[model samples]
Target: MCGIVGAIGSRNIVPVLTEGLKRLEYRGYDSCGVAVLKDGALQRARSTSRVAELQEQVQADGLGANLGIAHTRWATHGAPAVHNAHPHFSHGPGAEAPNTKPGHIALVHNGIIENHEELRAELQALGYLFLSQTDTEVIAHLVDHLYEGDLFAAVKAATLRLTGAYAIAVFCAHEPQRVVGARHGSPLVMGVGGVDAGERFLASDAMALAGVTDQIVYLEEGDVVDLQPGRHWIEQAQAGEGGAVAHVRISEAQRPVRTVTAHSGAVELGPYRHYMQKEIFEQPRAIADTLEGVEAITPTLFGTQAEQVFSQIDRVLILACGTSYYSGSTAKYWLESIAKIPCNVEIASEYRYRDSVPDARTLVVTISQSGETADTIAALKHARSLGMEHTLTICNVATSAMVRECKLAYVTRAGVEIGVASTKAFTTQLAGLFLLTLTLAKLRGHLNAEAEASYLKQLRHLPAALQAVLALEPQVVAWAEAFARKDNALFLGRGLHYPIGLEGALKLKEISYIHAEAYPAGELKHGPLALVTAEMPVVVVAPNDVLLEKLKSNMQEVKARGGELYVCADGDTHIHAEPGIHVIRMPEHYGALSPILHVVPLQLLAYHTACAKGTDVDKPRNLAKSVTVE
Candidate 1:
């Protein structure tokens, strides 16, 4: 998914828009651009590098615009290039342009406009000219030809021609004092306050407008807003009747820009010698940051509407893609067993396409680090369409479209996760999901005071315990030297630990490009036993629990096959290591919750092994940050 931001105020807007884009870069960062209405004319610039390049260019000149919009483009219809970037204009299409001898418009969009090709062919048939090979270019053309001095109406009319998801921001040369914004399946929000000169801002998330204005409100799907310096109004009419037109007042607490601390800690090869080793050391604080404000959650946390939705929901459908999907799978089992409710876990990519069994009583919970994951967003929309009106999300990106579309939201404060293979995100999602389970149990009166108190106590101790486990990363790195040259590996676990084995295998595959497979310990004999050999490394997730002895038996099976065993066991005594078996005795045995601790070593092993292979850990091959496009 892409990120978009717009601002109209007496203050210079180009700098504001660019800064906002930086704050929202985590949404998607393939390319970036900015379009500003300045001096009664439209000025635009775009680039295909990290946002830093665009920021460098913007700073080359005095950055200033009373009204402007910016975008961080994630490739959709075209490849990642300057031409494919957003802020597309209507220069050629018999449409008004910057050279239209009068006026032009620049538009930046986040979601895909499904009807772009058809719209482009229609415009071409109408003798309209075209510029870049982008779906967004159609909007610039439509806005220009359709504009009759009313920008909002032109946007409203233009949106009618498009299908699929979108959150678009538009600016026109003739209206330097104004801006227009609209959204459909995609998410958008506008921060509505300022201290000096009443400088209001529009951003994809509260992060972009953070420090500038914490008082922000979101624009719901199918909602549109018109902007003016210090004030704005809603576009009372929409092309579609599905989304409502309403005014929501936002307060300062709803948004906060974290004080970006400049860290001098450039990773080095001293002693422990890897970013993964260093990052592993950072897990304690990471868990704590994610736990911030978690206790405030109650049945009434989000208001009466959320309470009503929670009360009425008979079951849950946890939808996600990738690691978040794995988190959902774990939550599904937890919700059913602990919360005593039924749940269906679906990979978001397949959710909307399948003949989903959904209804009004189902609450669809979409999980994603960046809320822009395309399939997840699409699934959320699909569920809402089928009358599953209650939607909630546990996401890292609070400003992400996923959070904006849903009625309730829970944010994981993992901060900037630069690695392509998620580490902290997985654990934080577990934390959030556990809380969600507790919330449901509390609401249904399934959890008594003693149970709730015990769980919360365990939850509170997570950060500290996570700290102790993270300190073991140095020891894990010592084990990774063996993984560097391995061709295939088998991961073994049981019970809740089984899903964790799946996640560990996934993390290794995602970043390291390793051929790894996971099997439930019992199922190891069923089929995967054929693959275990002297050369194949078997990673046994032997957390101390009810299944520990059964897992030990599986490890013994691997040893019989002469397979090299790397046991991530809870304690040394329980591991029963032979001459060939190596063990990493965990700092603590957290019982059923041990998977949360055991998963750490696997993440470190993946990261270090990938680093040893010289792979790009932050941007793995063919993998974009978020899968906004299918």
Candidate 2:
């Protein structure tokens, strides 16, 4: 995943481009660069560090222009290096000579170019020298080769030869007043701003355009956009006889401009030390917002056509990745048990490649925090191709591609989650999924009036319940102090809380860099028990449920092996603090909703552990907030 931002404005656009990159840095931060058209040539600055370093480089060099394109890379095709940084330059034909500067075209791209090798060979044969080790360099050269005095036409023609997902923004040194952008699979949004101030912008996410503009146009697949001072137009690629992009025509389809509130205030760390901690603490508000105004359970809560779609489908198929997958796994338990519906959860990346039985009557549900996860989006498209047209998305961003692609959507009001390690987004997704479960159960006549009323009351009390759970952070911090010394951890849970254990393990590994794994308590003897020792720290999600007795036996197994146990147990569980067992009592027992409350302590544990380890809790290492590429 990478971030792309481009601007064509009256004033100096260097600050605008740099500011935009700062907002999108969570999407990528490996390396950053900017290229601006100035003095009838391209002026460029690149850094192997974060966007801040690139901004400093730009300032030191005194580089500024009215039109520019910038990128923060996630390093897919090449290592994180200045040479591999974006704003890649194409020196044009016969530019193999040394000391060629400002050659012709400068481009910033997001997504993989599958046919790059063949295109590189062809371009090199035509005397076009590539200066970098990026597939994006080939695209720059291709555009240079196809330049027929029109940058838009060149980009359109370049896409015809490309065979992969990409969202590209290109600017020609000769055509210094405009920037042309096109997206095939990756995301690109057009910001229509500066009508009075005379500016136009393009970015990978609308959050990047916050404060600068609220008028946003989400670009569709195969849509090519031309942005210039105060004006823009869009064109869609027309498929030829072979289903390849033959030509481009003026877009007749509607791409509405929607007003999205600025998220600049939400991303601020405020009093919290890190975004992860802030988000972890924000779970109460996030869950409340997600369930807000839900006075009753109705299929229309998801969408206007949700009742029709839900009635037609007999089963539920969930596609997601990482933490979202865990949320889906938890929902599978709820959907099957409470809704009386068969549910299957599939890892989005794996599901896209494997062929399986697809039922037309099955409702395909996709879960994502950013809603721009490349693999999940591809999997959704794959499911649609198999004739499962009934699609729904549980996502945070209403403007995300997943929401646009799906027929029905329940947009979780989780706000902007800036941390690379997810917290509030995961909880909000669970809230949304639980609501979906209730809606389906009501439609199936499995939920009576009393049961519905009880569920609704529980849903309304989630905010207060989460607030109580968050107060256990102090106890979790003490556990983190002990856990910070351990190199590995084992987590155990049963039934629905098993997925919570998986999420807990994921969080520890993701931010704290601890090698952690989770298994059902019963499965410990099957294999994971062999790893337990005096130094091993086993964390258990021991809620006071039917499985509590079975989980206690598993704790005894760990204790017999001299393993230290860190347990997050319910208040009434009677699992007290023993010599080797440290129990952090939960404030209350929240039946089917216990997983939601149980996860907070794990999040706090991960946050404090990562803080103790002195790791980057907000950004983490080798990970981005959104997975925009496969």
Give the best candidate by lDDT.
2
Poorly placed runs, candidate 1 (over 4 Å): 37-42, 59-64, 93-103, 193-195, 236-315, 359-364, 370-374, 384-421, 436-457, 486-489, 525-536, 556-562, 576-580, 619-630
In model 2, where do residues sit more than 4 Å from their true spots? 96-98, 195-197, 242-244, 251-253
Residue-wise C-alpha lDDT for candidate 1, range 246-306, written one tens digit per residue: 3343333433323322211122436644444455556667778877766644765443467
Q: Per-prediction TM-score, please?
A: 0.82, 0.98
**Per-residue lDDT over 347-450 for candidate 2, one digit per residue giving the tens place of the 0 to 100 score:** 99999899799999999999999899999999999999999999999999998899999999999998888889889999999999999999999999999999
For model 2, what is the C-alpha lDDT against the true structure? 0.91
Best by TM-score: 2
> In model 2, how large is the Cα lDDT of residue 264?
64
Clash statistics: count for each candidate = 4, 0
